[model samples]
Target chain A: MPRTSRAVKLAALPDGLPGPEHFSVVDVPVPVPADGEVLVRNRYFQVFPSLRTLIGGGVKGTPFPPLRPGDTLFGAAVGEVVAAPGVAGLRPGDLVRHWLGWREHAVMPAGQCAPLDGTLPDPAAHLGQAGVAYTALARDARVRPGDTVFVSGGGGGVGSLAGQIARLLGADRVVGSTGSPDKAARLVSELGYDAAVVRGGRPIAEQLAEAAPGGIDVLVDNVGGEQLQAAITAARPGARFVLVGTLAGQLAPDRSGTTAPVEIDTFQLIAKRIEMRGFGGLDDAGPRPEWTERVGAWLRSGDLTFPHVRVAGIEHAPRALQELIGGRHLGAVIVEL
Target chain B: MPRTSRAVKLAALPDGLPGPEHFSVVDVPVPVPADGEVLVRNRYFQVFPSLRTLIGGGVKGTPFPPLRPGDTLFGAAVGEVVAAPGVAGLRPGDLVRHWLGWREHAVMPAGQCAPLDGTLPDPAAHLGQAGVAYTALARDARVRPGDTVFVSGGGGGVGSLAGQIARLLGADRVVGSTGSPDKAARLVSELGYDAAVVRGGRPIAEQLAEAAPGGIDVLVDNVGGEQLQAAITAARPGARFVLVGTLAGQLAPDRSGTTAPVEIDTFQLIAKRIEMRGFGGLDDAGPRPEWTERVGAWLRSGDLTFPHVRVAGIEHAPRALQELIGGRHLGAVIVEL
Candidate 1:
């Protein structure tokens, strides 16, 4: 058995767009499981846009504790349990999902790990495409049949899956917005989006109005700021908006305070009776197991496909995350250990 | 019975604050009820802040049609059915609530009228205090017992009632915001608010933070713009925000688009997982009858009291509406026709 492991650690709290310098990949002794704990050998981990919020100055009074210097960067990962100590649900070689990523080996409490149903050929796909997107759509947005759904950052991993999930949920029309026209075209052609709107160069509202002339019934928003504002404008009366990410500002290189803060005109929320909700990983925690079962069934039935960007080697995780945050990656960025 | 009836008509759309000059009082032949219709002699009409939205150049594709030149400004009214033509549920003397106000007499379809339970001595109170506010708090906000509730524009018609209703619904603490210190004191002393934050001079967020430092579980927002922004800042994780009015912008004298649009940092929405929804009269249409019944029961039991400003004579309605929009009058503004 390997007696050493490698993990990414936060070297410093980032003030703005984080760079590779803020993270350090270092070798450490392999963790051993204690009583009622499991030692998992990570197969794959996710590098998502939300990592920006975690590394950027922490949200004031955030419910989840902010990552500090010297702490291992944590995220959802799929792995095989190499060792288990008096744990009822797990045995060595069992596949599980746990929040102990950016690492090769992790020692976690057995109860915190979820056993995968083995329906997906590559179970690591659950870390991104099938996880947050599924829970947010099913529990938060509650996408209904015949809903005219719009997704922001639709070319990204979760957004791409969100389009498919909306279709599965019986959405009549699914429109996705991406940063470039090429990606927009790809989203519609390959990702099952009914239509795609290019996000930049003009006010998102004007572009969205032109695309969704009638109005959006449900908005799965990954890019906040102006994109969200545009979705609000394009929303029909009684539309539902779910906040999934704030990638619009995640890629900005200039972290200067002088930049005018991106603003959203909330008047539309009142005038049109729009319902908006923000969701995070913790919010999806309770419903995740149910969503996982459903997603597994869909995967087994060939009803779903996940688009992802895989990077070989655990040493490349910092760069992979940077690529995601920099908007260089179009789909979920996965690190293969 | 008089053969003629007088009504207030919109003279022209105002660019800014509307005055009596924008309305014209004229006499017209009393409308005769046809089959399945009733001729109502309006006893009392409401002049609410939302009227500004109706007359202010229309809210784009507003469901409530913009009041045009020579068009009767419609609103909720409590009146006596003077004549009913084959209406099964109505009698000539029965009091009813309907959206046919700003007039001395209105001919309305029988199906549109909502019969008041006749529990209160002055059923005209049904138009303002006991109408939309109760319905919105119960249905839209979904105020649960032990919730920490906050009401913006708490001294106004809907805000005042929202405070009491939150308390009646078993809220642990009810905090309210008012534009003036006197009204702030009144809200805490006269109304059932646990505390009152005066909104002016300093940023409202500062005052609200000081008032409800722990954070609000539910926000019943009446004044939009900065008040809504401030509430969003002060909301707790998973807080429920119900948008009831945009009187904050309505009260602003400058109607120029140059004025910085009221901005809400929606990043906070995602960070805290806030749930926000806009509430309008139409939003309450489904639950109103049941809410009215519940309110009538509360009123009969002396468990509820409605504070309102009653202006005598139909001639005073236009000015009364201006007062409500201009933030001069406290509580619900009603005109006795």
Candidate 2:
């Protein structure tokens, strides 16, 4: 008898805030694994802001494919293999992480799955601090000793990890910025941030100037609007600004009270002798096992900590994703399947 | 007996476009060379757009001191040594290049100057193509084999040499954008640009898309504003945009008939994974003798070419600087004192 599986499917493309109406939970037959394939029973999956770009219309000028209506939402998931067909290393009980997710069961090529080493306290840790965020900060930004590091949107998924990773990488001072005063306090008190700039209370540039004083050596930007503008203004000569997200989006209210495109003064990049590069960790098919091992070590040694908000069951995945896009939740937002 | 030398002095910091009133010709007695110092009879000195920044209140932040009134405006000049005071590597009648110009003669420590190897036909070449432009393109930008390069302001000083350097670095196809149609034609006809985009004729983004349909892999940005915005739009995944200038200034007329701050979409930088870095070349005090040697070898082999607009005599220096700021001249602008 064939097993049955349930999955969350995209009902329609999103236009800003994605509601429950844009997703549907549907039942389907579990896929039969071919030779060199594994069947995974997912335990947890992630929902982050980058999903907003994918579900809306996809990233322009890149090959990021948009999901059509009725297509299963694919994402990183930690799961246990239920069936393995002619797979040498993977067994039915083997724990693994794969990109075929947002579903109860995923049948994919064995090579696409990475078998977890069972060192993590929970498999879901693969989706949080021990994954993309760590690699993005440690490798791409290369935060070093004596460097003044700043992470914008410090309460968010990547920002939280980035702040901690900068500390582990030996940053002299790690500063973060968040939209809420509570998150701002959390960054300094709980997270590794030496200081946090709270948005909406003051112009970000003034806050950052007060915080850094000397100037920012490295800025890992997650919020792009005024914060990014502020980062540019506060950047020191030969500073490095990593472009991570546009949480502030592209448009802003102009002086006439209408939305106009927000701009970056390119002159600053030249005048200040800054280097700004965009980073998309693990998306480009680079080496990840080394990064994964290092982060795992950090976690095991208790040097790294992560907080995640969870929504139980696959049906709540859409709501969880909405909460993430709305910036209503701090830290990583994951769904238990 | 002391020799009398006439030099151009900054009369006052200019409010905007510098006029003849902002400069004055002053006579001074040339100082005798001290031990380890060399006196040079100047041949040519460069007057490019960056001077406008120094004379106009200096660069914001980072300790760029403003030129005080009556101070002789100093810059790079190539000349023959007239007096050497027991300098190990220096002697009278030896050609050398030093950062002491805007006058008929300069006296400085021999260590502050580099003796020219007498490879080029004329010493003025050291102030133009054989100097900062070569280093900025080859070392800073690292133009590589088969790269599709786009140069903004390709008719002007650095842009002209940058395009040629890209070609010599094994770029498959090079595209350039300039203000005038004549310059656009010249980029393709006289310079090594494979194609050209004429600004103001069409939206720069549209023109760039049509010119490099495959997308630009490397962008040497000299004119910032709309050109930088367009380069960001036209960039391929993992493209590198070298921030060389901000000739577009700050505010530009938007489509809504209002002056808007020039902006770049940080989201696009993330999506495209583009790396944008500012280039300062020889200004930062680094070892350049190796670079000068390689570039000199290239120039000697007839692989490199440069054009310059000369303003004769010290009195004409201010007008030449004005012409460069006005974008009236092509290639390097030099003062023949």
Candidate 3:
């Protein structure tokens, strides 16, 4: 029997900021499990800023197809397996997390679904935000104990979790920057961050310098542009600047009109031997199986944690995305059915 | 018998461009060499732009000594061994190069003297300009075969030799930028440069783009300021921007009472994986012994070549330095006595 479910679809492409009008709710017949597939009823969907880039047409140089009008919004999700076709081990009613989508139910390849153990304090923890955030913080940045780390956009889902994970990794000082003072205080008080700065008012360099007087060793930047520029200035010699977002704006324009000016004191790099790297969560999945294990272990051990999400029903996903785009949410925003 | 020699002494420190008034000729008795020491009759002295920094008092970061009223002007020079005290393998009258001074005679440790082999075409070749220029080209930039290389200030001693050496390294295309059209033509026709552009009037990026349509793979930057900015704009993905000099100026002051704005798009580095390195020939010498051997082999094999220098007498070194500081000379300027 074919199952039916409600899914969020892109109604129109956003210009700069995505609004509720850009997305529409639609009822669709649920997919059936094929010979090597499992049918899952999705309980949680991950909403992220990168998804904004998808809704705003698409990002250049990305390997995936762009979202056109009336296309289903897709991402990683946690669900319960209701049926399996020739798939052993994962029986009916088994909880799993897979790269499912905004729909209520999905038929994914059995290989895609990983059984979510009951060890996690919450089932929603392993599916989206916590999973990717923990993996990026551990592997890519290679956060070590006694290292001073700066997480930009630190009040957001990934940044919030990354702060705690850095603390768990034995970071001596964890500094975070956000647009809201409330978020800043929450990060410092509740999320184990040593310091947090509210962005947009003062020069970030002065604030960062005051926050980490010894200097910042690792920068997990989720906000590029002016913040990145400030980070380069405040960075200790040999500091590793990681580029994970361009929330400020992508193309930095200069006097040359067409060409963007990207300047660093070349002497600083030579003196410090700094290394800068960029990575994305979607690309983190295939090549690195260790990421899944690490995140799973961290969740099981309670070394890393995230705030409870404000779940909206499937029809209210557009409203949730709007809240995210408006920077009205404190933590991860997920849609549930 | 002790040899009496006339050496150029620093008379005064200059506020900007150094003149003959800043230097004074002084008569001093040359000291006798002890064990492991050799006395050399200074023949040739090098006059480079770096001397300007040494004369303008001193720079904070670099190791150049501040000029005192009566201190001897120190620089690289080629001379002939006049006496050897308890030193083996070198005889009186053997030509050698040492970091002596603007003096007629200098007695120093034997280790400072590197014997010049006659197997190389010119004796002056191992002196100041040729040796340092060739070393900078081969080691610092790591010029490779079939690479499109661009050099700024190409008519100058280091830039001229760097262009030819890049060709010898099997560079598919060697382009250069100079201050004058005559120098540009000379670089293309006389030297081994594939193309040369007259600087000063237009942006370097436009000129470089026209000269090397494929884009620059390695940039041997001698001129900074706007040239550095333009090169960064014109640089291809994965290009290596090597900062070798900053003749234009360092630290351009913004007059707006605002912060000095330097935009660095992390995306530029991420998209191209570009590597920016800064090198001083002085720093390159200690770590890499292979640099000396490579340049020596190239010199002996006739694969790399540089122009004969316009020799000034030892007494005329101060004038030659003034000329160099005023940007009058094309190729390397050396003082011979």
Q: Quantify all predictions' global Cα lDDT against the true fold.
A: 0.79, 0.77, 0.68
Per-residue lDDT value at A66 in model 3 = 64
| lDDT of predicted model 2 | 0.77
TM-score list, all predictions? 0.93, 0.89, 0.65
Q: What TM-score does chain A of each model score against the native chain A?
A: 0.91, 0.89, 0.86
After superposing candidate 3 on the true structure, give the runs of residues whose Cα lies further than 4 Å from its correct spot: A1-176, A180-182, A186-198, A214-244, A250-263, A267-301, A304-337, B1-147, B152-171, B225-236, B250-263, B280-288, B307-337
- Residues B210-324 of candidate 3 have per-residue lDDT tens digits of 9988777777766665665556556666566565655553212212111112345554444444455445344223423444455557777876665645656677787887776
Candidate 3 lDDT by residue in tens digits, A211-276: 988878788777775676566666666566555665554222111121123455444443344545
lDDT of 2 by residue, B1-337 (tens): 3479888899986656777889998888887889889999998898866566566555455345667787888888888899898998777889888888898889998888888766566678777444555566676667779888898888787888888888888888899988788888888988889999987788999999988988888888877878888888888888888877666651122221111136666767887888888875564244446555666677788787776788889889888877776677778888886
lDDT of 1 by residue, A94-171 (tens): 988888999999998888888877656678776856667777777787888888899898989789889988899888
- Tell me how many clashing residue pairs each candidate has: 0, 1, 1
Clash pairs of candidate 1?
none
| Per-residue lDDT over B1-337 for candidate 1, one digit per residue giving the tens place of the 0 to 100 score | 9999999999987878888999999999999999989999999888877677667755654355566798988888999999998989788889888889899999988878877776555687677555667767787778888788989889898887788888998889899988788888889888889888876678888888888878888988887778877887788888988887777766777772211256655567887889888775533345346666777777778777778889999888989988887778778888897
User: What TM-score does candidate 2 get on C-alpha atoms?
Assistant: 0.89
lDDT of 2 by residue, A161-270 (tens): 88888888888998999878888888998887999998779899899999998888888888777887888788878888887876764111212111113566665677
* DockQ scores of all models, one per candidate: 0.50, 0.51, 0.18
Q: Which structure is stronger by TM-score: 1 or 2?
A: 1
